[model samples]
Target: MKQILKNSPPTRGIDHLAFVTDDLPATMGFYTKVLQMKLVHVRRVPFEMDRGQPPYDNLRHYFFDMGHDQLLAFFEYPQGLDKQNRDLPGGMQHVAFYVPPEKFDDLIENVKAQNVNVIGPVALGGRFWSAYFYDPNGIRLELATTRLSTPGGIVESVYQSEEEARKELETLFDDPETVDYWLSQMPLKHQ
Candidate 1:
């Protein structure tokens, strides 16, 4: 059995994530038009030519606010990178962003208007609702809102205490005698 130690809280979350793209302008247009992410910043990294250069290099960087302090960034090299299938296994999974419950309805409507296949503002219980869609580059994304209780307690079972959960599991479908026998078969640590 593992020894017990205090649990530490997670530190500050993501500031941004960067992806390399072949066509910078097309990608920017898609994010702005479909996703409604604003173009927050753009800059170029100058290549230093020996002494007192006249022309700055052409490498470019772009940033978009994906809400919160979270960001979506892209880099455009003069000779661009390959476009990889983001949906492949071990490839880019989906990105989910939090939304206010009130805004979820509007967000759902906006995303659908983009003609993208949007699935569910389906309430997972509580006040949470989540909608899923694919971005222009075929990257799957989820927009979600936390409602009354967190979503999991509604869609998925949740236990306030492990002991309570364990007791409930033990009593679920069995008589006392079968429960006792089954409990004996479980590992001591799990028990």
Candidate 2:
């Protein structure tokens, strides 16, 4: 008998997701030429050195339009990928970009034409479809399109009242095993 808050925080959508890249030119070429994402901006910024590392002059920061006001951005440093921790698998595993249903097939073909292997236009229990591929920087990327309706396509029920929704969410964390599995997946600092 918990009640959902009526005044939820205001948020639009993702602004951008940024990553470090070794070669800026090649990364830009792959995104713009292969993935067809438009290169929106490029800027030179002062490099921020890590503790115990000497300061470098500058780094290149660039962005690509992922449509729907979202962006995929990159940073190129002087030491390149070496600036990242090669010993630990601590960075992003992959990124999934949403593509409209109409354009999904064509985009898959475009990726294949670039000589990159495309994994699937596979269905996710009929809720959505996705295709996977890797970028020039070996970053696994996915393009997906939702097949769901405007609301409750995948949810078992659409709560009519805030109290109903809150009641359901209250029991969501009851499974200790599920919680433990998620916690275990977090990258260890010294691993």
Candidate 3:
């Protein structure tokens, strides 16, 4: 509602989401062995280049294939940083990865077999359900899947139905017309 800006047309999905990890072996193990993500790339960044990168040239940055060609990356910083609190503004609380429903239970069992405690298959208010756990980096992660079967797959599974969204939005918006306007812009109807 703030601006009538156009959405980016050429862009696709996320390329990567970078996180900080102190232990590369443990992080790599959990991601590769437990979660089954492949380690695709690893390198040291040159400090003089990429001005926004960590100041040290020896910093190790590595990537894991987080499915659909998206990379999940991590940086092993030398020192002098505190553990981040997800409650802080602009911090990530958790990341949820989509799992096909067929693979959901097996993934959860595999995680638990590796001694990771999980807290779901909880209903996320739509067809989507999830199991939450922590990585070696202490990053909360969720493996989510849908109970509803459809060709749209993960995207369709998580999308809110008009009735479900309107019910929640009604409590927040004082104007029904505003909700209707946004709902019109949303692709809530199934194809």
Candidate 4:
């Protein structure tokens, strides 16, 4: 049985997702041609009226409409710009884009044509699959497709209220057997 907590703010879904790219044209090319996301807007940050500072300069900005009113945005900075890699162990990890289960393989093939380093179609438990690739800026991205959530099938954890999930986690404290099982299920990097 499941229980619901009172007074939790419901998610209203994504507004936008952003990334920094060294090669703006190439990055835009991949999202447009491969993933089929459409370019819907472009703009630069206005840094006008600064006191004794360098004149306001524009950055190359582009936004893609990733459907459901969500935008995927990228900012192109010149080479040797500040960067961070999200691949460190226990790092702030990957971003996932959902796709129809049937098109998942074709999506992989399309992205592969761009010659990006990618891995998987890996199992994320039964009936769901994920593929991983790194963007030009070394940010890992995932394309996940699931057929696992159909009615009367094995229930998978996809959405859980934080408090409810936390309560379940609280039971793991000092329980060696449960802790061991939980630890074993984590990816190798987290072990």
Q: lDDT of each structure?
A: 0.68, 0.70, 0.83, 0.70
Candidate 2: residue pairs that collide: none
- Candidate 1 on 89-163: residue-level lDDT in tens? 868887877776678778778878878788887777545567889765556788877766434432233223445
TM per prediction: 0.60, 0.67, 0.84, 0.68
Ranking by TM-score: 3, 4, 2, 1
Please, what are the lDDT tens digits per residue for candidate 3 over residues 79-108? Answer: 556888988899999998988888999999
- Give the range where candidate 1 is weakest over 10 consecutive residues by summed lDDT: 153-162
- Which candidate comes out best when scored by lDDT? 3
Which is the better candidate, 1 or 4, if ranked by TM-score? 4
Candidate 4 ranges beyond 4 A from true positions: 1-10, 48-56, 88-92, 149-168, 171-191
Candidate 2 lDDT, 1-191, residue by residue in tens: 23333443376667988777778888998999888989999987775657532345566789999888889988775543344433368867678887766787888898899988999988875446788887767788888776666523322222224344334545776766554443343322231
The model with the greater TM-score, 1 or 2, is 2
Candidate 4, 1-191: lDDT as tens digits: 13343333386677888777889887888888877899989888655674542243676678999877899988777788656756667555888887777788888998888777678879876456789987666778899887565622222334444444445766867665554454444322211
Best by TM-score, which number?
Answer: 3
- Best-to-worst ranking by lDDT: 3, 4, 2, 1
lDDT of 3 at 115: 91
Worst lDDT run of 10 residues, candidate 2, spans 151-160
TM-score for candidate 1, please give it. 0.60
Off by over 4 Å in 1: 1-10, 45-59, 77-89, 123-128, 149-191
